[model samples]
Target: MVNSSEQAHTEIGPLYPTYEALRTAAQPVHPSSSARRLLWMLNGPLHSAITVLSSEITTHGVNMPSEPLYDPATDIWHPIAQEPVSTPKVSSVTVGVCQLEEWGFTWCDMHEGHADPPELEDEE
Candidate 1:
């Protein structure tokens, strides 16, 4: 008895949960942890600032960066560039998305164990 729109959303509901989860979770991890954990998992190296921040999160516990160096102009940290910066750890998922976007990475349902992001076929 579901409408087409409901059916469509239900069909797509399981995909792309990162944004939803991060958005709705009671306590989303700080951007520093999210960035460092993801980066370490992908590249095997922690952001220089995150090295200290991670230890503090492990020991003392914190949500914001221990030593933030953000730049209000760009709405991001200092040394803005394509590659992830070592200093000025990110503090929010929004900023983390910006960093990932810079690396050509986008939110994907596949990341949450669902199908990969859809790709369009080239017209022949």
Candidate 2:
């Protein structure tokens, strides 16, 4: 059966035209040896953090009120009911890596150091 999140995704349409488009847009960084090692060290933590945050957001809702409640004692309004945030599941380490890359976190690459040098501007 299709989950509510899947139904929401269907309703909202895709965030990208295609998966290829998403990869292109990610502009994945080519890491140096040091950066590569850093990324290797970070991968597990990053993946765990993403998973935890995604779970929290899905479980606790996005703080959006489905219904409002008013308190006469202090004249305060609060959410009577909250609507859970519909988010696509981060199913794997690869998915987490892709998200980090897309957000310019630069920890996706796992190749030998071969980053392009920065271009220098010509002095007038």
Top TM-score hit: 1
**Cα miss at 112, model 1 (Å)?**
49
Taking every candidate in turn, the Cα RMSD to the unseen true structure, in Å, is: 20.0, 19.4
User: lDDT scores for all predictions?
Assistant: 0.41, 0.36
**How does model 1 fare in lDDT?**
0.41
Model 2, residue 9: displacement in angstroms?
Answer: 0.7
Per residue, candidate 1 scores C-alpha lDDT tens digits across 1-124 of 9999889889855333343355476534344333443212234333333322322244344353443334345566533233332222322223355666655444453265555547889999
Which candidate gets the maximum lDDT versus the true structure? 1
For candidate 1, report its TM-score.
0.18
Candidate 2: pairs in clash: none
